[model samples]
Target chain A: MHALATLIALSLASPAAPLDWHPDLSSAEAAAEESGRAMLIVFR
Target chain B: MVRPTTLLSLVASRFECVRVTDMAGVDLDRHRFDFDLTSCILLQRADGHRYHTFGGRTWEGAESHLSVPALVRVLVRTLEEHEKAELPPRGRSGPGRTVEALPPLARRIEAGRRPACIHCHSVHDWQVEAAKEAKRWRPQDGWVFPDPREFGFSVDPIEQERVVSVEARVEGLQVGDRILAIEGTPVLTFGDIVLALDRSGDGPSVRMRLLPVSGGPSASPVERVVSTSRGWREPDPLLYSWRAMKWNLDPSPGFGGPQLTARELGGLGLAPGTFAFRVQYLVDGGARAETGRSAARAGLRVGDVVLSLDGRSDFRSVDHVHAWFRLTRRAGETVILEVLREGERRRIDLPVVGLGR
Candidate 1:
C-alpha cells in the first residue's frame, strides 16, 4: 500500500515527457504511415 | 538548446514530431523551403503536402521568431489545412533552380571531414566563400537577401494569411490590402514570400498583388511593382562571419584572435586606442591547418599582434578586420598588414587568395 502511494506521488511530481520524437525522418514517416498523423519536423 | 514550453508541448503531443539536428535529414525534392535558416519548424502531411513553415530571423539574438500564440495559430491552421489533403502542384514549393553542392565551404567540409554535418545558417557563409574562391567576390554580394521590410512593410507571422504592417507614410499599400503574390508568383504564406524575396537576385523588379483583406466574394486584386534598388539590401553580419572564419585560418593574411588591451597596445608602441588583434590561432583546426599555415609563412606567427590592415588602425575586432578585407577588397587584392612580430614591427604585403588556392 505504501509503495503504491509512493509511485502515485512520484508520478504526480514528475512531468510527463510530452512528445515522442523520432530519431530521423524515416522512422517518423514509418510511424506516420501507421498512425495517419502528419509529420512535424523541427530543424535546429 | 530547445526547451519545450507548455504550449509547444501540448501541440507537439498531437503530431508525429521529428527533430532533425542537421540539413541532410531534410527532403531536397519535397521539402523545398528556405535553407538559410537556423531553426525551422515545418509541418506537412505524410505524402509531402507542406502545411506551413515558421522561421527567418535577424540572426543576432537568442530569441526565436515564434511566440506561443503565433505557433498555436499555425498549428490550428495546419490542422485545418491538413483536412484538405490536396497535393500541392509540383515545383510550386519554390527552389526551382538547380540545387547542387553549393559554396566552396561545403566542398571544403566534405573534403576535410571535420564538423561531419552542415547546418542551414552556415550556407550563407559558404556561398560567400564560394564567390571568393571563384574570384568574383564583391560588395554587392555581401547583402545576400533583401528583407521585405525594405518595401515599407513587415509581416505578421500569426496572420500570415491576412496581415501586413505598412510603414508610416507608405504610398501604395492600404490597410485593407492583403499580399497575394510576388513577382507574379502566387504565395500562400509568409514563408513563400520569404523564399521568393531570398531567391530574387540583385536589383530585380518584383510584381506583387494586394487583395481585399476581408475574405470571400467582394475581392478584386490591385497590382504593384517593386523595383529593388541597389541600395535596398542591408549587409548582415551572419554572411560576414564566413570571411571572418576564412581569414582566421587562411595563410597570407587570414587569422583569428582577440583585440589587444590598451596596456598591451602601449607596450607595442601603439596608441592607447590602437586596434590590434592578439593572434590566438594561425591555424588551430585540422580542417583549416593547410590554409592557416599561410599566415605563418607570411611571418604572422601565433603570438604575433597585428596592428593594422591596409595601413589603417580603425578595425573594430578581428572579425571586423576580416569583414573589411572581404567587403572593401576583392579576391587576389594585395593588403598591407602591420604586425608586431617577435617584438619587432614589420610590414607584410599579403596577396589575398581565395579558398582552396
Candidate 2:
C-alpha cells in the first residue's frame, strides 16, 4: 500500500511533459512517419 | 504553446507537433490554407495528405473563434477520425512546389528584396501580383476563405462544429444543428468547413449534412441546403478592405477621408447614405504616387467632397469606395467621379490605372 501510495503521489506531483515541437515540416514529417503518428503543424 | 497540462500532454502524446514561423521553402502544393491567417493549425498525415485544419479569425478579432477547449476538442476529434479511416499512402506521390517556386515571387527574390522570413500573407500578395501581371485576375479572386457568417450562420465558438445560430435567410438549418459534413466532406472543425466551401467553387448553393442537437444522440443526420442569389462567398467591403492582399489589386483610388457628417451631407443636398467624403490626403509620393497623380490630373483636388463614383453613392465609407473599386473595377477602365468642388457639382473622369510594382 505504501509503495502504491508513493507511485500515485509521484504521478500527481509530476508535471506533464511539454510538447516535443519540431522546428520545421521536413523533420516533423520524418518523425511522424517513423512513429506512425499524424502531424499537428501550427503556422504562426 | 497550448496548456492546461493534462490536455496538451494528451495531444503531445498522440500527434507530432510542429511550429512553423516562416514561409520560406515551405511546400505550397501540399499545404493549403488562408494566407491571411496570423496563426493556423493544419492536421495532416506523415506524407502531407491533409486530415483536417483548425484556425480562422474574423474582423471582430483573431481570438474570437479560438480557445483552448475548442482546440482540444478538434485534436481529440481528429484522432478519433484518423483511427477509423483508411490511411492514404505513407509518402508523397508527386513532386512538391515551394513558395519560392511561384514565378512572380521568384523574380522578386532574384531582385534581392528577399525577406529574411516570408510571411504567410506575402504568398497571397505575390499570387495577386502574378495574376495581375498575367491578366488573369478576376474580381472574385479577391474573395477567399469565405466566412460562414457570409452565408448566414454562425457556429458555437467553443464547440467549433455545432451551429449556434442561423440567419433567417438560411432555410432548413436550425440554431442547434451540428454539422456532420459539407457537400459529403466530413467536417470536424471550422477549418474543414472553410476548406470545403472554398473547394465548392462559385456554386449558387451548398448542401450540408447536419445532426440536429435537439434530436438527441440517437438522431439521424439530415441533408440541408443554404443558398443565395448574391454570391454567397462575396465579402462585405468593410470586412474585406483590411486584407493586406488588397495592396496588389488595381484601380487604387488616390484620395480618401472620413465620411461626410450628416450636417455636411445636408448642406451639400446629398442624402445621409450618399458616398460623400472630403479628400483629406491624396497619395502623391512613394510607390503609389501615380494613383494620386492620376486623380489630380483629372481635377480631383484636396478638400473636394466626392459625392459619387460612376453614379453609385451607396458606399458605406471611403474604404468601402476603394474596396468596391478594386474588387469590381479593373485597370484600363474609367471611373466618373462626381465631386462637390467649391459648392459646385463637377464630374471628372479618373482613369483606373494599374499600380504595377
Candidate 3:
C-alpha cells in the first residue's frame, strides 16, 4: 500500500514539460559540452 | 526527482539530463555508486568528472532519505558549483571500465550463463562472485555502503546533507551541523557519504568537516575525526538478512521456521523475547543439501524447537540467528544448538561448512 501511494505521488509529481533527457552518457556529455551545461545522470 | 515547482523545473531545465535504467554500457569505474539503491543521480560535467553523487537509504526503507525538495536544493547547489569552473577533487574521474567486462561476469557471459537483463542488484551479485572466485571472500566483504548512523550521526532526510543529531561520544559535532566533506571529498548527499565509508572499509577512523547551522553554510568549517570499532557496519541482524548478497555467504543454518509467538512461548515456558523457533523443514535436497544433511546427522530434526545457539538467546528471530551465523561464523567452526524435542532438552553439534567451496 505504501509502495502504491509513493508510485502515485511520483506520477503526480512528475513535471508536465518533459525535460530533454539524452539517451546515454556519451550523448549527454556531448550535449553538455556543446551547450556549456552540467549533466544530471540518473540511474534508475 | 524534482516536484513540479517552478524553481525546480527552471533549475532542472538548465542541465543535460539522462535516465539510465540499465547497466549494460555503463562504465563501472567512471559511474560508481551504491547498487543497492533503486534510484541514483550523478551530477557531473560533460567530461564525466563527478561533482557529487546523490541517492541512498539506510535499512529503514527505499525512499526514506529521498525528498523532492532536497533534490531541488542539490540541483541548485550543483549548478552553482558548476558555474565556479573548479575541477572535482583528484581521482574523481576514471578510465572507462564497463560492468560486462568485469572478469567474473565476462567469464559467465562466455559460458552462456549471462543474465537476460542486468539490473542494479546484479552488479552486487557479480562483485560477490568475483570475490569468491579470487578465493578472498570474507564475512565483512558483505558489508557495503555503511550508513552514517553507524558512525554515530544521523543526516536529516529532508535537508539531505545536514546533521540532525549526534551521539554523545562523537565529539566536535552537533545537531543542525551541515557536512561539507568526508576525507576532503565534497559531499552533498547521503550517497556521497556512503561511498566515502565504503571506500574507507574497516578503517579505524574517519575524518569529516562540518559547517555548524549557527554559523550557517558560510561558517569556517570544523574538523572531526571519529574512530570505528569492529563490526561497526553491522546493522540489525533482521535487517542484514534482507541483503541480496546474503545468499552468496556461507554456513546456512540448514533449517528454520517462524519465531514462536508470545502465547506459544508462554505455553512452552519460554521468555517472550528470547530466541526460540520451531524447525519446519531441513534443506535435505537442494544446492544446500550437505548443510541439511550435516544438521540431521547431528540429531537435529523437524518438530524440534531451537532454544539458543551457542548459549546466546538474545536473537530477535530465527532469521536473525541465520544472519548472525553467516556474518560471524567461519566454515570450520562447530555450533552447538540447544533444542527441545518432545519436551526434552538436547544438544546438537552442527559442523559449519562453506557453501560452493
Instruction: Give fnat for candidates 1, 2 and onward, in order.
Output: 0.65, 0.66, 0.63
Query: What local lDDT does model 1 show for residue B22?
Result: 67
The collision pairs in model 1 are B247-B254, B247-B255, B248-B255, B251-B294, B251-B295, B252-B294, B252-B295
Give one digit per residue, the lDDT tens place, for model 2 in B1-357. 534446645664578887777898788768888888777788888777787777776656566676666776777877887777666566654447767877887887899977798898888987776777788887678788777877778888877778887887777678888888888767777877777777777776789888987789888988888675456767776566656666666668877888889998898887776668899988989767898998899898999998889999877666678777877777889999888987799999998877653
- Kindly list the per-residue Cα lDDT of model 1 for residues B1-357, writing each as its tens digit: 433344556656677887676665355546655555545667776666666665554333222244555565677667666666654333223332222355454465568754567676555456556666787765465454334665456676556645457666355555556777776544555565666675666553567787766535678887876554444454433334333233322323456688888888788787788778887886645555544665667666778788778888876566666666655565567778788887888887766655553
Clashing pairs in 3: none
Candidate 2 wrong stretches, greater than 4 Å: A1-16, B1-6, B86-88, B111-113, B255-281, B284-288, B298-321, B328-357
Docking class of 1: acceptable
lDDT of 3 at B240: 69
- Model 3 segments beyond 4 Å from truth? A1-15, B1-10, B86-95, B213-218, B228-241, B256-288, B299-319, B336-349, B355-357
Highest TM-score: give the candidate number.
3
For candidate 3 chain A, the 10 contiguous residues with the lowest summed lDDT are: A4-13
Q: Which digits, one per residue and each the tens of the lDDT, describe model 3 over residues B1-357?
A: 534455555677788888777888788867888886677878888766778887876555677667667777888899998999854332224447777877888988999998777887788888777777788777767777777777777887767668887877566667888888888778888888888878875665788887877787578888877665555666545556545566666778788888888898898888766668999988888668888888899999998999888898888656568778887777889999999988899999989876855
